[model samples]
Target: MSNISVSENEASSSEPENKNSPAVIEESPELQRASSSTVPPDVPSDEPPDAPDGGWPAWSQVVSAHIANMISWGYGTGFSVFQLYYKQTMNLPAVQVSWIGSVQIFLCFLVGVASGRLSDGGHSRQLYATGAIICIFGMFMTSLTNTYWQILLAQGFCQGIGAGLVFMPASASVAVYFKKNRSFAIAASGCGSSSGAILYPAIVQFLMPSVGFPWAVRICGFISIALAIVGFCLLKPRELHRVPAPYLDLKAFKSLPYSLFTAGSFLVYFSLFTILIYINSFAREILGLGDVKSVEFVLVTNAIAIVARPIFGFLADKFLGPVETFGLNCIALGVMAFGWIGVHERIAMYVYSAFVGFVNGGAQGLFTSAISSFVPDVRKMGTWIGMTLGLCGFATLAGPPTMGAIVDANGGKYLWAQVWAGSTIIIGGTMVLISSRLVLRDSAKPSAI
Candidate 1:
């Protein structure tokens, strides 16, 4: 492992020590205590101080990170197949079916605070290994269950926790390797989810009738295990003296800009997943498409995302700053949400899915870079990011069920749900614009966030 270090004088002079700013000028005693375990005592300290950002090691880490996203988010987001299956086979209501996905997403985000802290303390590899084992176990257990509660405990809670442990560390590790090309790297990693989205739905769609549901899910589990093994082997952290930070940094919210940004993120996530969960059902129930035809909507959405995410990442890096790009993406998402209201035919729904998928992919891909602009200390990146996502976890957890309840209230009509989704996304986009303005007003460089 290679370690990077900065001199005390350089650290002090680069950024002013402001209490209100989300900047850490010096490692506190607590952080110093935590740093002890991050590095081995026998390792020589005469190496170098900056990462070889474009080297083989850095790129390998990127590849590993991409695999991690594919397994955790790609497979996780494709739960719409299971959502449809549970609705037809088990006679479950939309709300209950929504919980299975929501709980998985919720735990993935909520557990990031702890997982981020662990990564910051140099436990990245251990977290990945443990999560892989637990996730594999959870999937196998899910194959044996027939009841909702059993599925929820096995697939929802167990798998969710495992994914969280893998997700944060893999994601945060990318920052350790890149600076100038950071957005592009993050975007590339995110495409894994899009790839997974394309592959997994098609797999489930093809396999369900032939092999049955239990074996279909188990096959997905086996694929996850293989990917996790690859990720564990290649995802190495850039060795550095890590500053020990609190598991959760409540003080990050003290900055009004950060607080507003977090609130906006919460609202954005609240509506972001509504379409992904219900689009298949919408196509089948409302548009009268068959099962095979309906799953095509999901395939189109994720397939477009593969191209859109990297393009948006490049645009953000070269032209639009991350905050501006993210805000615009959210605005586009809101407008697209409204487009769903007018979609009645298969052609109309397909067009809607393509437009929304592109915009949503851009928004999600740029999210980490947009948030990273706010923090001065890169060491605390995991903790700050964890805090943002942890707060937003509640919204992700509640969004689907609330939308399901609205659909149920309207006797399966989706008009109100569309309205609800569009309105919240627009509101969230407005808050993002406000946060961007504050960032611009406070600093000469808007990218500074």
Candidate 2:
């Protein structure tokens, strides 16, 4: 006991000298002591290094940031040009040719769930680069293919993979970057698709006659390379303390409002792409318009949609809630689908295009906003969105071929397909409308009551 007490006293006395001694210093002991210490770091006061603040990206920054996405969407419009190729060049039956576009659209969105997860994991840039490279390769490969199967593999699968990589990340990034004006930001992101829908077809038409399909496709491939470059340079994610989100969270879909909204999204996209894929062909053959006029009709709708998306998004945020706006737009789209039943002349086609573009644009912007509302927990949104989009991807895959089959069964007249599409729009619109009403009712109820 006397020896133990004397040893303790000697150890305590040596502790101060050991801490002060530099010659016999060891890192682990000092680290252990530092961990137990309550005092903070004794460093000079200065502004800490941090990521650049993104306070509502400037107009030029906004456009520059979004341009690459727009070009990607524009690249998708190349499928519309395929309508002309199938009908005029390949001389394939409408039903058979429709599969190419349907498969492409299906694959693009189908892969979005996986891509969304990748983005959440801090690998978006690599995923995007890989997609662009694959898509460019597919485009060049498409120019060389003659058979339907070859084109499907190269254009549909490979190109579709590229598109899938770009879509969700590009869209979700808008939500991440802009909170104050989220609707407008989403609308801006959407411009890429709209521009792609319009410009690609028009450009292809101008070049296909003179340069031939192969060279035209190659030109588009080169353009995609440029697009990918810009995207890598400018499309940066803002650094934030992100809680890792599940890539596929099914439980979030249990919310009734979100379920209904997702159902409506599936219906809308199914019908939307069906019309987009078939409209140019319908305008040319069924409506008896010239090829140039038919393409112009398609172009006009996409161009108008660019403006309408931003305008309606603003209205949804400012006046109506996202649910209300989605319902209204769905209703308008139904009306436009019905109007298509009577469209034959160029003038009527133009009117129909403008109406459909306006309504569809609004619906798209509203749906993105509404989905986020239901899954208010930020960390869970990516996973919830992935599941919903997966469902939507399945629908997009089936819609075009199914519509084309209807046209074929009806002796190459699109009237049957048109009626089916119109009915679908009405049903989807009603679902969204009922859901919106329920949301409004809930919001209006007084807490005291």
Candidate 3:
């Protein structure tokens, strides 16, 4: 007993040195002292360093991520204002105008593959700075555009490409700063994006009358540039020594949960974006509302999002887990979309829009956390998140136009379009449900292969 006591004392005395020592590579990824044991081969370990989850350093990263999201996706969602303006003034068919937003979203997703992979390789800051400059340049150019083609090239291609570059890195920056409260952290980070979505419409709706279109757009650009500079000055990657990873690691899909989640994400984005794009048209045509009323509808929806996203994340972290929460949210959103078919009166439509925004907004931000939950290796999270987003970008590209075409073919009735959106979202939810169950099973295992 004395020998055992002395040995324990000696080991305890050496514990500080063990904490200070460099992480040793184990032959097996099976048994780990890190948070989870599902890490794959080729990575050194699941955790290189413990995340400083609550310090100013960690929360500051969350703030930086919020700024990044505000500049990219928050501004992107504001494209509803542009869509409304173009539809009213362009005289082009809705289908043709829809292509502009589609291309913009498509490029945003498409660039994720390269940008996300590079972010994993320790290039996050550089990529974000470059992307910010490009986006600012694109916005300024958009302010100068008079022709449709010019808008497409400047706003759609350039802005979209720039957003794609910054978004995944922004999401990944927060992932490295927290573990236990990861879902809430990522969800809280989305607050800026939702706020941006709300603020932008007000910016456009108020500015266009007082400052005119060109200056209003330029002001929006200025806001984006200012916020981006703040983010660039402060944002940091916690794991400074993250090893570079492959842009397209097909091996990741071998896990059925990951693959199933990807498919679910594709369908979710595909169906989700359609409602956002058409809300203005739905208000003006179906409800006998005017331009201002339509803009208000968009504003109300996004405003609800500002509050909903973090709540979703909190629930995910506290009770449901990210995957299960995401699946449930998807199902809820599907039900809400179908409910849209029943709303026709002005008051009812307003309420419906708010609820829809609440559900969709939370769902949008939830996926970032959900996808992160599946990636055991935090170092490669950017790669995995970017790849999934890149693939889902195709759905975003096709969804708005596909729904628009359906509306056009159906004599401008939204019944079929709503039906399609609701069904697609429900199907996506089921896929996520399957993924959540699969992941729960894998986590129950004593050892991961």
Clash tally, candidates in order: 1, 2, 0
Looking at candidate 1, what is the lDDT of residue 218? 89
After superposition, candidate 1 runs with Cα above 4 Å error: 1-49, 444-449
Off-target runs (Cα >4 Å) in candidate 2 are 1-65, 441-449
lDDT of 2 by residue, 282-302 (tens): 888888877777788778878
92, model 2: CA deviation in Å? 1.9
Q: How many backbone clashes does candidate 1 have?
A: 1
* Candidate 1 worst ten-residue window by lDDT: 33-42
Candidate lDDT values, in order: 0.78, 0.66, 0.78
lDDT of 1 by residue, 223-284 (tens): 98888889999989877777768998887776666678889988999988878889999999
What's the candidate order when arranged by decreasing TM-score?
Answer: 3, 1, 2
RMSD of each: 7.6, 15.7, 7.1
What lDDT does candidate 2 reach at residue 413? 84
> lDDT at 133 for candidate 1?
80
Give per-model TM-scores. Answer: 0.88, 0.83, 0.89
- Ranked by TM-score, the better of candidates 2 and 3 is 3
- Regarding lDDT, does 1 or 2 come out ahead? 1
**Candidate 1 global TM-score:** 0.88
